[model samples]
Target chain A: MSSINSSGEPAAVRVVGGWASPFVNRVVVALKLKGVVHEMLQETVGKKSELLLRSNPVHKKIPVLLHHGKPIAESLIIVEYIDEVWASNGAPAILPRDPHGRAVERFWAQYIDDKIPPGIRVLRGSVAQDKDKAAGEMSTALQHLEEAFVECSQGKQYFGGDNIGYLDIALGSFLGWIKAVEKIAGVELLNEAKVPNLAAWADRFCAHPAVVDVVPDADRLVEFTVQHAALLRAVNVPK
Target chain B: MSSINSSGEPAAVRVVGGWASPFVNRVVVALKLKGVVHEMLQETVGKKSELLLRSNPVHKKIPVLLHHGKPIAESLIIVEYIDEVWASNGAPAILPRDPHGRAVERFWAQYIDDKIPPGIRVLRGSVAQDKDKAAGEMSTALQHLEEAFVECSQGKQYFGGDNIGYLDIALGSFLGWIKAVEKIAGVELLNEAKVPNLAAWADRFCAHPAVVDVVPDADRLVEFTVQHAALLRAVNVPK
Candidate 1:
């Protein structure tokens, strides 16, 4: 899928990301949506790579898209870059053309970024003392997300209406982890009964060809979650 | 400054913000830079306005830009909207025209958002036990910011090279607060010896005509800080 730029030269695209990271998957899904060919360099947890460190010295985190050897960090920013760069390549529009619609999409994306971690922590907690409270908070967060889906989707299949866009990729990357979280917590956080729109949206998102190709196997994610549950709980313990 | 759209109707612009909020000032500066006319609705901290609540139902936060009765929340997002909406209005460019440059600006803006809060917490801490540690962390954070300015500015007057851009607006909004924070914490965070480039950039940013028009008075900010320090410290105290 390497294409000629305005200079009539082939475009160089590469992504340095972690396999298990939802943030990384966001970039992968976006690239696939744009039909851009790129190499993915997997980064190992607990060990930093020279290229990753060189590319993103400040954050030193994964999901760095190296476009022509220049790195762009932060998953959302990278996704926006992909959308803008590949905009005229006949790829699907990830962001709305109008400023207001784009801003709305960005607002929800940032909300998801801020809200999802706590929900994940709720599911990660193993202690019975915190279970109920955590679950309550997680449920409230999920409900807020459901409301967002309702408002943005507005009787459509996705947030951008009739297609997967920025918000879908941002939140949908968590499909595998949400499944693992539900099983570990033994609570149905998302369902047709609770958040019908979000549940259906998730199903549609997971079934997308691009999403299907990038999302990690559900069983592998579950196994990883079980193995790391104790460590996650230890880290999430109240200070 | 109202202009007719394609429909031949005047644009209605309103800003719901607080006097002492750095986030609010960001929008104010952007509007001033874009030469857009906007009514500024000052929001009382303890009492949010009906307009704010109605516009930003999810976050219910200030610095919401109401354009044609539609509300766009979040400071950075609002700035982007203002820039995009006024792109052809011939105002000075707040963001770079090129995709790569815009992405770099956004990457730093996000960095500023993530790094500045911890520094603010350090300044808000009342106890001496945590002051040194917090100060150390803040200094490290500042150093990282300084590195960014060096890389992005490349000896230019601003992050966008001789012009105040998105990053400048984002980080420059905190200049007054940084002054208050330094006085309250009894440490100079930005100086000639350390982060000289950022210090100079802050001076240039504050001195800009648009920034001068919107920035809260330094004395007023200091007084406000002194008044709110105790309340802020109480909230900042870790559980």
Candidate 2:
């Protein structure tokens, strides 16, 4: 392998993604957390790139991490792959070292996956009333997560204990979309009053060096969401 | 494993689950594959045991494997935990040896998890037409999975090559559920003609020692589904 590049990318490693996708952001934060420099290939939204299709033939979704031309797909799956491949490269483990600890982190990560996406789908629903209902549901979810963070963090700054980790990346990657949802729906989420601790944690997570740069711009995500929804309506693609 | 029980379980390991949950079967098969004899605690449907609630407070779901009094939840995640904890005990790996191989297997496992559950949900729908629609979708999914088997199995007997691996357990756990769905919906799934290879694989998978006993009886599962649906309607429980 060649030397690391200025962008902190490792030679021969590449990520196929879209700029506004939180799923793609997951890969970026993972690479950055590992201090690895990898080339990024931005694919257009709603249109699959030949590289992405070839890389992830099964799902044909983005956030495919290619190492030495062999591709791995699924955002969290790619993050776990990165952790394994680079475990010996002096990077801290993305998952916890102990099996039970790892299992705990994985459980929370899966919880985030299960909870967040459905709320986002409702946020993207056609009716403003539905968005409000979704926002309320997401608020309750955040309160539970605040309790979870307290249990998992052990008074540390982050879920990985003073650093970003699997669960942090799992939830934090949605910072931009969360923002866009609040703006478009005009409803508060990650409710500071109800989930004050988690709301604070969200701030620290987004401001962390690993996440600050890679997260999609909130305004851009808002515009993209609005345009994409209109385009979906125009084309009448089945949801 | 306390000299290995005739039932094939490990000591100090307990599986809190239901008789008919495909998710629970995944744990049983994985444990049996490793020749571990874990205790079983069967929880009634529509009821939560104190142990299950305490072990998995967040989701309050079943299939929690308690090892040495510590709990791990989620079926596949528990499987991975089992693989890691028992890695040095001479059992073949449930996941692959290499990271890329592991990633590939993980991808397919995620695909199976994504594709199977929704079909089951639709199978439980109030209307027969919705079940038919779901069966059609699932049949198409099986066709794709058949293609995946060709790519993954490489003429071997199973997805993990010589034995069942992550993807195998992921989909294989649902064999009985597929049967129940077929019986209840009155339509073919895992369409033998369309996905002949996967169809054959299912027969061999069900007959395997690790799976044969653990999979819930098909007739029992159908009965459970009908009863559970009726119970929900009686109680006016939210879907």
Candidate 3:
């Protein structure tokens, strides 16, 4: 096994992430949970730097973590890399030790990551002529998500239970977005009556210290969204 | 470290995958790389049985690996899980230890995975007007992909290097579909002259033993495409 650095610090971890992107937040949560201190560089979707572009030439998107000038892209991939490097005994690892249990958590995280984006897509396209069609699609996706949460949360506090693990970090990033999406779309995905467990899970997830600490300013996020909403409306992009 | 069980196997691992899915193939490649003996169940997509449905009720998708009856869903997630569990000391892992390298590879994988489908979307839409728009969208996406390949390869043998790794495995799954897409759409994303490195990479990928041994029957896939091509054409789909 590799020895921990004498300085008790990871080798200069730096994160290039946007304030409003839940995708970026997943990585932040992982870094925090693993107790890895990183230099957080604020970025925006529209304005990418040469460093960001060069570091991640293919995607050229934020949530690019530069560890000693080496970059890792994609939020979940970064999380996995974090787990592998910071394998401190008894420290909060992002993955479950049991392979099966780990897989279960991973399955739910992927489900939520893939499906939940459509609701935001719907909200982005709200003013379109086919808004109803997108809404229906978003609604079905949310229904599936609600079902997913019920199965995932059965007999567990977090997705891996007790301490917040991979799934919690994965889903926790979206809690802020869920409220924003609901307000923007005028549709409640996680209604108290419709999905009590998920609603509760969201509450517990937001309350996690690791999550609460790293999330961007909620008011700022709302302002960003309001600005973005206008931009979408002007372009008639339908998201 | 855990002791290897009798017969030198770490433990019994099984993959629930569909023959038609690239997602499932990602896990298959990882298992082969690690030299883990496991069972492979060929599942029918969109027509899953109770076992699969129950195993992954949230996503209800295949590429669910049951290690000692514990299910892991999502292809990339399964790949990571496989790497974590069956990883050999000093042996190749799908992701790089270096953060930046890992990030770049992951970002492209996610970008290609998310963006490439949109190109296919234009081919899949039924409207007459939609077909032309889809072609244009697809062309632009391919342009980005070709340019990305030129930038990312930087003369590296594989996305990870020398041997196939995560990014190669991720993109390799799409090659089988690309030819069919090109034939049907009458548009070439990877011409020999246009994308020599990518074209060469695809060739090297297909001929790899791990990729060749377990890949679904190409002839059968082409036959399926042949039969379905007319139907897709009738709808003015990509075919």
Candidate number achieving the greatest TM-score relative to the actual structure: 1
For residues B46-89, write the lDDT of model 1, one tens digit per residue.
56677788888887887888898888999999999999999988
Task: Judge candidate 1 at residue A164 and give its lDDT.
Answer: 88
How would you encode candidate 3's per-residue C-alpha lDDT over A51-95 as one tens digit per residue?
888877756766788887677777777887888788875577677
* Chain A TM-score vs. truth, each candidate: 0.87, 0.88, 0.83
In lDDT terms, how accurate is model 1? 0.80
Q: Name the better of 1 and 2 by DockQ.
A: 2
Q: Model 1 has how many clashing residue pairs?
A: 0
Highest lDDT scorer: 2
Best model per DockQ: 2
Q: How close is candidate 3 to the true structure, as a TM-score?
A: 0.75
Instruction: Please tell me how candidate 3 rates in CAPRI terms.
Output: acceptable
Cα error, residue B163 of model 1, in Å, equals 1.7
TM-score of each: 0.90, 0.89, 0.75
List the candidate 3 regions with Cα displacement exceeding 4 Å.
Answer: A1-11, A44-57, A89-91, A124-156, A184-186, A216-224, A232-239, B1-18, B37-40, B43-51, B89-92, B97-100, B117-157, B216-220, B229-239
Model 2 C-alpha lDDT per residue in residues A122-203, reported as the tens digit of each score: 6765333477678887877777778878988899888888778898999888877877778877888877787777788888
Query: Residue A193 in candidate 1 has what lDDT?
Result: 86
Q: RMSD for all candidates, in order, please.
A: 4.6, 4.2, 6.6
DockQ, computed on Cα atoms, for candidate 3: 0.45
